[model samples]
Target: MKFTEELREENKDIFQAIFHHPFVRGLGEGELPEDAVAHYVKADYEYLNTFMQLYGTAISQSKKREDISFFQGQVAFVLGDEIHPHRNLCEYIGIPYEQLQGFPLPPTADHYRTHMKSVATDGLLGKTIAAMLPCPWTYQEIGRELKEEFAPEAEHPFFEWIDFYAADSIDETVDYLKKRLDEEAEAASPEDRQLMKEAFRKSCQLEYAFWEMSYTKEDWPIREEVLK
Candidate 1:
């Protein structure tokens, strides 16, 4: 089996737990409370924009030319093609670009950002890989669930976004990470291994929280809209 497939198989329980989470169900069906949905949509918009910005920062901060070049290519791909999913999501949520500027980021967003910054600043490729692993892995799992349980016609705007992040690109990202992890492990000290493991667990917890936050009455207002 491919490494991605192997990893997915190994993490099956985690993936199932996330997909079955109420937050993910809401996203799949668009059944979240209106205010909660809107809050989540707005939060997602800000999150993606910030994510792109931080990728730039990571690239610039990379001391190795190879790392810089690799990230530069990723940046170009994200800006050129990967951004369309976010644009589609913004349109679906009725959020304008200007509106996102004033949006208040959720506390989870801050935690995620701080974690990313720490990973980048630490300059350990293993730590960075550990921090980044959750994103593509989670996306791939979401895409699989969307395809299995959601609309096949792709009428929902969020479906595309899910497909984009969780489909083929996720496999690619995981493959890259596996190679990097191996390389980093070969060179890592015991302390580095401990740090990487801690980062990985923390990142996974954040991933779970991210999905949970999306389903709350406090964050999403779709349920209220339905009631009204």
Candidate 2:
């Protein structure tokens, strides 16, 4: 099997947990609390902010001009589609978008972002793309799955959210990522290919933590009172 296929098979348990998480389940039912969604929007903005940097790194490091073009296109997608919509979400959640930007990231956000940076900055080009693949690919997959199961109406709270992920654009983007990853791994030896799988696996695990953190509103251990 190809590395991406193998990675999915090896990590099927975590994938199941993510696909079946209460947060995702709630999204399907439109039963999730707005507060949780609010927290997620805030944290995810921070995530996308750092995510842009990683894409920039990938663009700089890529050896092929077409690879550079793809990464640059992804950067634009992040800004235009990924990040800009949060402004309206901020409005819906009754917080100014500017205020959402000011909130400090929770520990989970930092850990995932830090890991992404480390991989994109330090890993092989193939592995760096490997690290980046899970987010879009997995999200769109879940979105497509739930969109069919829920068939949410236009007015549903989470409908637009589902639309974002289930868009044809997302599928196209993830397909590009997957194609690149497959091509990169095609000629790689067994040992080097394993590194790509490991990177993709770790990113998938972090993807789960990211959703859980938003739903649980995970907080850092330090207390404000104790700090003083």
Candidate 3:
């Protein structure tokens, strides 16, 4: 089996859990609360700086020219393609995207970002690719799956959100990521391959936590109690 297929098989439970998550269900039903959407958007927007760094750092760490080139292209696409349009959509949805400046990091958000940074900065090629794969792959799969479940009209509240993930561009990016993962894995030792698998699984676990956190509007768990 291909690395992507094997990895997915290993974590099929988490993928199912994510697909069955209440947040995803609410999104499919077009009944997800606006506050939840806003919070998630804000959290995602706030992380872009660190996200850019992660990719850029990965590009620098890569030994292969193709890897560097791929990451550079992604950095541009992320800033120019995704964020600008997402900012516009946030306006339509009353998400205060502009007000996300210096937003406080929720626990889950911080943990997720820190993990990405660790892998990009600390891990080798195979491990770094494994850590980053789940986001693009999972989101694309979930978006396409959710759309199939709901079959919503173009005017549906979350229509554009669904379309964003299901877009041809996103499909191409997912393909690119999977191809990179395969290439990276092929060159790995048995021990490093196991590390790569663990990284992928951990990233998937964090993906689930992020959705749950967004649904519940998670915050610093004990900060208030500590202050008191």
Candidate 4:
């Protein structure tokens, strides 16, 4: 089996958990509280900044011309294409898009960013890609599956969110990333492949946590408790 396939098989349960998470379900049903949606938009907008930086790290680590180009293209996509949904969500909720630029990262977003930064800065391109893959990869799956299952109407609050993630363009990116990851795995030592697998699994786990964090409108517990 391909390395990406192996990674998926190993973490299939996490994917299911993400798909079934309350935030995901709420999105499909358009039942999420506005506060939760607003928090998600702000948090995810901030997270995308770190996401783009990781792609830059991937580009710096690239030796192949095509790899550099691919990473650069992804960075552009995150900036140009991926952020539109967040912007729409912000407008829908009356938050200024510019405000998200300074929005504080909640605990979960901070931890996930820290995790990706560790791998991205570890000087291994393959591990960085593995760490980053689950975001787009799982999101594509969730968007497609939710759209299919819920058949959300255009009036649904998150219909655009679903459509953006379920787009053919996202599928193409996931396919290319999987192909590239497999190619990287073929040239890797067994130890390196093992590390890649671990990175992928950890990312899958974090993906689940992200949905839960959004669903709960998670905040810094210490701050909340201190104020209480």
Candidate 5:
């Protein structure tokens, strides 16, 4: 089996949990509270900032023009195409997209960012990509699954969010990333491959946590000034 396939098979349980998570179900059923979704969109907007940074780190680590170009393309994709959902979400929330720009990530997202940053800064290209894969891959899967299951109408509040991830463009992006990871795996040591799997699993877990965070609107227990 391909390395990406293996990673998916290994993490099937977590993926299932995420699919069944209340926040995901609410999106499909068009029943999620406005506050919950607003919280999620704002946190995710901040998360994407770090997401693009990882792509930049990947570009810097790449030696081949094709690899660098691929990473660069992903950065553009995230910055351009991915933000449509945020805009739709902001409109739904009655907030300007710019207002959400500097929103702080809550606890789960902050930890997830810390994990990805560590891998992107210190790990080899394959492992770093592995850590990053769960975000796009899971969203693609979730989007496709929701589209197939719910057949959300264009009027659905979350339609743009669903459509964006389920788009052919996202499919192309995930396919490219999967192929890249498999190519990287071919040259990786067995130890490196194991590390990659671990990264993939942790990321999958965090993906689930991210949903939970948004569902709960996770926050630090005390005000930042309390400690000061």
Candidate 6:
């Protein structure tokens, strides 16, 4: 079966909900709050740091030496190249890098970290890849939307970040991930497929929560006034 078909069959609800979300739809059209986009970039960078650390630990624990080395390389590329470049996104949104680093991660972020760690440590590589698939795919899809909807206007802060990730590189990232998932799936057992599906669904739900957390504000009068 085709990869897209397999994804549809395995994650039907998640795919539908993501496509229907207002923020995601807006992101597709190059419309999102500047603050929100900045939050996403910062959040994603921090999450990668934690993820890579866990991936490193998992690789160290693996008995398969060659597989351990492969995972190590994957972690390095994702951290050193893919994730590190956007570390300064906090500055663009008027937040200091130190402040972003010190800020408490939301529950959604914690959930994502836990899920990835679990997959990396205990599940098949294919399952782990499945768990990681939604993030890049979602970003690429949103980027496509932004390119189509907001390229001409290009004035919004959110659109600025959107355009950068959704560019040609994002397509390449998605293609690479798709190929990885296919290869992993071909080698996976039925149990591994089930594990991958479960982890993928959980990760998607956490992703939705991550976005929601960014938009939510605590009811603090002083903070509200300051925001104004």
Best-fitting candidate, scored by TM-score: 5
Error of 2 at 105 (Å): 2.0
Q: What lDDT does each candidate get? A: 0.66, 0.81, 0.80, 0.87, 0.90, 0.64
TM-score of each: 0.76, 0.92, 0.91, 0.93, 0.96, 0.73
Better of 2 and 5 by lDDT: 5
What stretches of model 4 exceed 4 Å from their correct place? 224-228
Candidate 5 has an lDDT of: 0.90
* Residue-level lDDT tens digits of model 6 in 1-228: 955458757766766676667666655554556666566665666787876786566566556776577567768667566643354345345665555554445557766888887787774566666777777777676566556765734455455556656778667656765776686767778877777777777877876777675655212234435877
lDDT of 3 by residue, 13-87 (tens): 999999999988887777777777677777777666776777887787788897799889888988887775356
For candidate 4, the lDDT comes to 0.87
Clashes in each model (backbone N, CA, C under 3 Å)? 15, 0, 0, 0, 0, 2
- Candidate 6 — worst ten consecutive residues by lDDT sum? 215-224
Give lDDT tens digits, candidate 4, residues 1-228. 989989988999999999889888887877777788878877888888999999899888889999889888988899899877787677667778777567788998899999999977779888998999999999999989889999988888788889999999899889988998898889999999999998888888888988778878899867755887
Worst 10 residues of 5 by lDDT: 96-105
Clashing pairs in model 2? none
Instruction: Order the numbered candidates by TM-score, best leading.
Output: 5, 4, 2, 3, 1, 6
Off by over 4 Å in 5: 225-228
Which candidate, 4 or 6, has the higher TM-score? 4
Clashing pairs in 3: none
Off by over 4 Å in 6: 19-22, 25-42, 54-92, 152-154, 217-228
Tens-digit per-residue lDDT, 101-220, candidate 2: 656788888888888787776656777888888888788978887899999888876777778889998988888777878888997788878878888888899999988999999888
TM-score of 6: 0.73
Any residue pairs clashing in model 6, and if so which?
Answer: 28-145, 28-146
Q: Cα lDDT of model 1 overall?
A: 0.66
